[model samples]
Target: MKIGLYVLSIVCLLLIGCGDEKDSTPLVETTNKNQKPAITSKAIEDFDYTDYALSPESEEALANWEKYQELAIQIGYLKKADLSFFNGEIEDLKKFIDQFKTETPKQLLTNSIISRTAILETMLLKLNENLTLENIDDKLKLLSVRELLVAFSNLNYQINKKLESDIFNEIQPE
Candidate 1:
């Protein structure tokens, strides 16, 4: 009982010694009234939607642009060794579409977007479909991978037309 009491006392003293002064700043209270400018007005509220007609192609192009942006983000997680060769393909695709439309046509942009999207979709399908089970060499797998890589290479030709010079100038193989 004496040892237990001594231990308890020593713990209490140690804890007290470790305590620091508490912060004493008063919290500031803010009210939104008189704090900021008004952002909306009735003058901007009555715009009619029927007068604006976006072409299907333009919509498709926009969608494809967003998709490529997502792909670019995905590529950031990929190692340069794994994706270096294909990284420019999507960029080339963007350049191609950019050149073909120069401001993608309303009707044709949609078809182009669909076609571009299909390429990624097909590539993904091929990747996911391959089941390289236990060292049985897949000739089809090699062929598909080679084909997709080549396609990506061609796409990079356009996508990274400017950056390819930089990539080639930078890579130093050991």
Candidate 2:
């Protein structure tokens, strides 16, 4: 009876120890802030994009670009706030952004625009990494989503600024 009890204790200890195994995936480096992460689901439409009309050349380029269409659809998914397939949507967005970075249309190839897209791509990658962690919290997920939206908005602003400048240049006396 003594030996059986000893063996049972050892088995219980082993099970407890195994239960504490840490996840292998590394966490994204975060600031040691004690504050709770805020949900920053700002509406994309709030950004003033009205003044930056795309030129006919840019419109035609976007119309013909399947990657750009895919990008827009992905953004639409994010905008919808549908949590059912949110993980898959983020994954899809990351892939589309990667492709868009390399195949930007000629009319949209300004240095600033390209730089902004690169920043957006980096944000998406970080979000993807965060999602891959085994113990992701809602705060981290929401914060990452907010960051992703901000990066995309910045890219849109750059593109619009470039288009506006191009239009202004065309109307100016040479």
Q: Which candidate is the best by TM-score?
A: 2
Note each model's CA RMSD in angstroms: 21.4, 11.1
TM-score per candidate, chains pooled: 0.28, 0.58
Candidate 1: misplaced stretches above 4 Å? 1-66, 73-108, 131-139, 153-174
Model 2 has a clash total of 0
Against the correct fold, how does model 1 do in TM-score? 0.28
- Once fitted onto the true fold, the runs of candidate 2 whose alpha carbons sit more than 4 angstroms away are 1-61, 83-95
Candidate that scores best on lDDT: 2
- Compose the digit string of candidate 2's lDDT tens values, residues 1-174: 999999999999999988967889999888666864332335433433432334465555468768766655665676555333335566676667667767787888888888877887787777776666648876676666677667766766676667767778889575
The local lDDT score (0 to 100) that residue 86 gets in candidate 2 is 37
What local lDDT score does residue 89 receive in model 1, on the 0 to 100 scale?
51
